[model samples]
Target: MPHIKNALIRYRIIDKALGNTYNPYPSKLDLRHACEMELYGDTNGKHISDSTIEKDLFAMRQEMDAPIKYSKAHKGYYYDNPDFTINEKPLSEDDLTSIQFALSTLSQFKETEMFQNFGFALNKIIDRVNVDSDARKSDADIDQMIQFEKSTAAKGNEFLQPLLSAIQHQYIAYFMYESFVTQVKKQRKVTPLLLKEYNNRWYLICFDSVKEKVITYALDRISDLEIIEQVGEKPSDFKADLFFRHSIGITASAEARPEKIIFSAGNIAAKYINSQPFHESQKIVLDTLEHTKFELFALISEELIRELLSYGGDIIVQEPNSLKDELVKRIKQMKTNYNI
Candidate 1:
């Protein structure tokens, strides 16, 4: 259960002294000096304090559950049981497995820019896990057995920390945002509330005081951000769950409402959709070898249309004439654009 390797080394040194029959009763100074010699060698390096020795003994007894006991006559530490050794208690198999699993899970984010500041701490834990497990299970080893999605140098990830800080500190943030449709940039002042990530893209979901509504803004299109001023109280009316209740991707249109939209997908697209659903509200109405039908209670946003279109001939819109007509109109526009 040693977090750092030095603790393990100190435990071994104490174990050796405690179990040494000839050395019998090594006092506190004897233990500390022995540890310094073993760790720092004959270099006369900074001596470890008596408290350090005391803590090491305490950690051994408490953390490792070592049978350590003090003899009043000997005036030193010794083990109640003579046969116990530090080597016999590395880490339980279950413990090692859990630590390895945690390291593997963290390996997914260790490479991302968002995790760079924590790289040293993460790497130290990884190294400790490797040593404790007695297996050099690097990222490559985990990759061979199980694959994880590759990390990207995703845009707007840099803003995550600052936006989260602003939210925590109750501050208003000012930034210039570029509109995708209008192709125009405009200054926006908003109360920072939340940072959302979807499909590796970052988004700022905040209350727009000027517009008197909650809105989602893409981080990539945002620039020149400044934490403007402190706000007395955040808009209590804005509930994240309610705001994104009918969301599709990052755009939760103010005018849109959640409605049931049913669609059928061919074999290939059905396989993909079954693996990764379109939305949380997506439900399979029917499943078969040829085509599978699905129903989604979600907003009919541009992202929904765009992703559905990505499936091309593999999917058919089966209900809600409004969505079908919109798709038809888009298809016609696409054909006209292609001069087909």
Candidate 2:
């Protein structure tokens, strides 16, 4: 497995070098240099030999049946078919079995017209695998072995394709949006920047031209989306990761700064939180038989408070008096609702 993995890595490195038209022509020495730099750079300057690269090229050409050829005129290696990639090649029986099983599982979407094209594409791949009737039976057995949770159809999923198109083409999108605070629908024109999926819901993070700030809109709340011919202005300094750095979920307050939030969880909830953290910044501050204290940096938002509330009595906010006060207020409200 290690040998196969190493060979695959080398194959990818060579393939990329061969396909790169921008770089200088990749000679044998150049290929060795690239392999050494990528594969063995951190290992005390371990070197890759010319013989190994030659064998790799030979394996790709003969063993893998890849359309690889050397050009003495260009002094480099190139694929006879420019579009060819190693990933597109045929798979072994085991690989085919796994792929068939995965495809069959995904075939559940075949019932939906929105996913018809995706299902067709999966079927084409299965056909290309050339599985027999026995393999088909094996796929059925695989399906019995594995199962997915039942998922209801989400609203506005049909708009996913057009929104994706708008993001790709850099076109300004005009959509009617309804906020939870108001019953009135308003027209919005924005440049869609990124699509974020959280808790089975999709949100479009766009630069709102009117607001002059980045805003997130739930896809389900958006309607009558129209792509304008005018090109959307891409923000010069906008990065999706940085934009959501301090946010727990879709809700973010520009004025709110990230704070070091300290909290304690009971034994059971501690194990759960340790396995599946709320954020990347989660760190264990203290751990004992009684409880586990954890710390993380994030902006205080309603989403964060709601998440904390979900744990109920299992979690307790330690520091940040503001968050603790909010939690107390919410719990008081809940108590009032129950009249307890």
Candidate lDDT scores, in order, read 0.79, 0.79
How do the residues 164-276 of candidate 1 rate in per-residue lDDT, one tens digit apiece?
87888879898899999999999998888778877778899887877867778999888888886687246766666577777788777556678899999997889899888
Q: What would you estimate as the lDDT of candidate 1?
A: 0.79
Candidate 2 colliding pairs = none
Query: Which regions of candidate 2 deviate over 4 angstroms?
Result: 1-147, 253-255
Q: Give, for candidate 2, the lowest lDDT window spanning 10 residues.
A: 141-150
Cα lDDT of model 2 by residue, 144-171, tens digit? 5443344554666656756787888888
TM-score of 1: 0.57
Which candidate tops TM-score? 2
> Could you tell me which 10 consecutive residues in candidate 1 have the lowest summed lDDT?
134-143
**Residue ranges of candidate 1 with Cα displaced over 4 Å:** 1-152
- Model 1: clashing residue pairs? none
